[model samples]
Target: MAVSTPPRRASRAPTEPGSARPPGRGRGLLARATLLLAVPAVVVLVVFFVVPALRLLWLSVTTPEPGLGNYTAILTDEVSLTVVLRTLGMAAIVTVVCLLVAYPYAYLMTIVSGRWRAVLLAVVLIPFWTSLMARTFAWVVLLQDNGLVNTVLGAVGIGPLRMLGTTAGVTVAMAQVMLPFVVLPVYTTMRGIDRKLVDAALSLGARPVAAFRQVYLPLSFPGVAAGATLVMVLSLGFYVTPSLVGSPQQSMLAQFISVQVNQLVNFGAAGALAVALLVVTLVLLGGVALLTRTRGTRSSAGAGVAGGLV
Candidate 1:
């Protein structure tokens, strides 16, 4: 009755939580793959952006007879100071204008039907479809003396304005182009807002505006901060619209940098101003990041309180 039994198969050991991964599934495999995928983009960025930026910084201090003379001029020269201040001022105005125009439009997008939302979204994004040059030129036409804008204004007894070479025209064009930047971010934030919270606020006898102010507005603020920062930074470096619509007297830092490059051929001064502008942009972005972080913390706390109420 004794039959020869087949040799017993070897039992595999169970993997423990802290155990090493199997050969093909190494612990760091995903990280290595991610690094591999990012290598090309990292190389491109270093070659293009980082290399040019380093050269620019080197030129700022070393070119055109060396020393810190170029940076000093940016700080001490009256023309440079004026242009720098003007650029900052204009950027602030553009940021404010974009935010003012975007906030309500974005809020509306969140409340509308799907089809209407699509239409509104397309409207917000229309500027991106056309070329920047084309859009700037279109603004040039509309902003020229006796152009549609001035003509409409004239009908209301406002005589043909010198809109083509004015800060106002430049502001209008800049705001329009920068609007979509603000709108898209704000809309995304608004869309994520819990409608039930607003309803709950209403049920608690809060006024419509009060509910929005207390419950919804705080939640949407990070988007506002992000959009505003983007618009402000872009406006600081804006050249085409301002150069096209603004006068030499109303020129911003970008135009000043261009003059140094193309007109005066002062590469050192150009680099210095460019560095200054870049520094300011970075500072703004950092400030916005800090603000958004604080706001996000507050928002999360508020959201938690609201959620508990629900």
Candidate 2:
């Protein structure tokens, strides 16, 4: 009895595979809350956007004798092709003009002081605060035969030229409308760029132009891509400005769609035109995204290599 050892302590067994799992109560509540918030947005999108878009597609196929007639018109009709070509051409021109104007403007904004930068940004956004239709009407007033622009031209001894009803008029108006979109993105990107990189290029005997082309331009390519895509896409669907300022020959697909819907009562043709415009826009955007992605990847790889060498 005296020599009896103390009772051996028992070893505890490890927890079973699923026994240590955390309780799902908190996670379940979180998930339920997320679903509750998201469902309304999903429902709205489905009801208003997805449903109407699908209806447009169905109309394109089912209307006008339930064949591909509307789509066929796009290829077979010379007038349709001409309108499409003109729309694309105008969009391209507007995009180019906006980019050219916006790039330097954006670059300047980056170099300016913070107070002036905010003022400049406010100026860019002023047009956005006003009604777009009103802005378009203002363009019409300026471009009209006896309007301010024409009066100025006459005062300068030049004959009052027809600005309205020309592609140039459309381009000018569209470019002005789209300028803010182009400028903001480029400016944002430029602001984020390291100024030291530019300074280093200069210190290395690179000219300002070379430094910009070699360093700044490559870095700002994403902004350029974004702005160009934005302007082009918006220009494609421009209706009010073009209608107010452009001639029948300068009519875009959006105007054509409107004519079919409102004038001819041809919903099928209108739907088909809408679908065609959407497809073309998607293709252009996809191409631009691909090109931007390729350029971005190359830039990243080059940066990595240069970093490694250093």
Candidate 3:
């Protein structure tokens, strides 16, 4: 004969006064702890970036007897309009140039052996480790009249192309700096791509070029979009390269803003321009974010369909 034990008691969490402990309490505690760890970073951003940005925004309206006249002038003034247009045009050109050069190089990186790929990557990255001023001055040296670049061009019957202190010089310098940003993203995307899909396309009687165009190029759009957006946005506010390599006539929005601040002491106008720039940046970021999201969704759906077929 066996004796049955008393029924096992239900386990309950320790209760506080007038309340029972809730479910997922451990998770709640963990989240609070994580938030606590983030406090320093939040504090730093608030103290540094957020506060300064808000202050600037406040100055945009207040510094010159409190009106939106600064913004109105930006829209109406010919010189200000020209600078804005020039900035947009330069950023677009640099983005296109970087994309054109980066795609092939990134593809090369994907196709090469490990050693060669590392070398290529290092070539892309070495600029970051160098001084920006040094690089700009180096470009200046190469670009100046009677410099090594002109000398080479002179040998080739294209001597003294007048690249220095021109839009062309600014474009070249900006492109050089922005290229690595494009390459890194595209290479990362291309590296993870499934080449087997292209092989399958080829097995279906498609030519190599056709297979690549149909299979690989479309797959790399996310990275391409990301890199292009990065380069374009960064090129907008570029000051150093353009200031050194370009002239007053070639001034972009950043230099215009600088002139208002340093030369004219028009802080209100500068703040307005800065706010305008910040607005444009936010708009571009929002548009690209939507585009990338759509692309990502399409990619995911395509992958799911392909998996189902397999």
Candidate 4:
């Protein structure tokens, strides 16, 4: 005869009145930790960049009796205005030249493969590895009167061109220097593109040129815009190449600012010029951003509608 044990009673824990669980505690901790890590970089920027920028603004307004005199002088001075215009024009030309040169080369890189692609990329990047001063000096040697370029031209019965100490020489050097800036962005964008889309278009009876113009060109605009903006902005503040290769007539804003500070001993004027350059750069960048944003919004909307239809 076996005795049957009673069923074991279930144990239950007591619940508190307000014990709701907090969600994503781990994620919250991670965010807090990231912010903590970012503090050092923030401090460095404030100390180095923010402080100096603020000081420059202060000097621009207050250095010479502090009544916007410096700014007014900049506006009214014909020489100052001319320098600003020349800077703007030169920057625009350099940007355009860089885009034209870089786009074709970048596209070629996308189509090629293996060792050939590597060789082409290295050629594009060679300028960056070379010293800027050395390159400028080399250009000077080649651009001077009775130099290699002129010799070649004479052999062809073309010209003994006066390139050194002229606008043309400066423009050529600036374009060469800015080429890599344009190429890297465009090449990165081109490499990420889906070539299969072009292939599909081709299979659907679209001509090769038409397919490229319709599909690939639109996709590459972002890179083009990026490269153009970079080249334009950098060209605005260029000093050495223009100084060494260009004439007094082709003086850029930076060179003017340098003359004010170094030769004329005019801090107030220099500060004002610096501020003006900063304002112009910001305005152009803002315009570019607005235009790109508008285009992006429209493209996104069109894509959404197309997807819905399909």
In order, candidate lDDTs are: 0.75, 0.75, 0.74, 0.74
Candidate 2, residues 1-310, lDDT tens digits: the string is: 0111111101111112233333435567776675565566566666866687678778877887798888887766788777777878888899999999999999989989999898888888999788878999999999999989999999999968889899888899889988988898778777778999999999999999999999999888777777887788778777888888898767887887788878988777777777777677657766776676667577763222212211
Could you list the CA RMSD of all candidates, in the order they appear? 17.2, 18.9, 16.0, 19.5
Candidate 2: count the clashes.
0
Which lDDT tens digits does candidate 1 get at residues 11-113? 1111121222223444586866755655665666668655776787787788887888888887778898888888888989999999999999999998889
- Models ranked on TM-score: 3, 1, 2, 4
Which structure among the candidates has the greatest TM-score? 3
- For all predicted structures, in order, the TM-scores are 0.84, 0.84, 0.86, 0.82
Residue 282 lDDT (model 3): 51
- TM-score comparison, 1 vs 4, better candidate: 1
- Model 4, CA-based lDDT: 0.74
lDDT tens string, model 3, 109-217? Answer: 9989999999999999999678777888899999999888899999998967899998888899889988887998788778778889888999999999998888898
- lDDT of candidate 2? 0.75
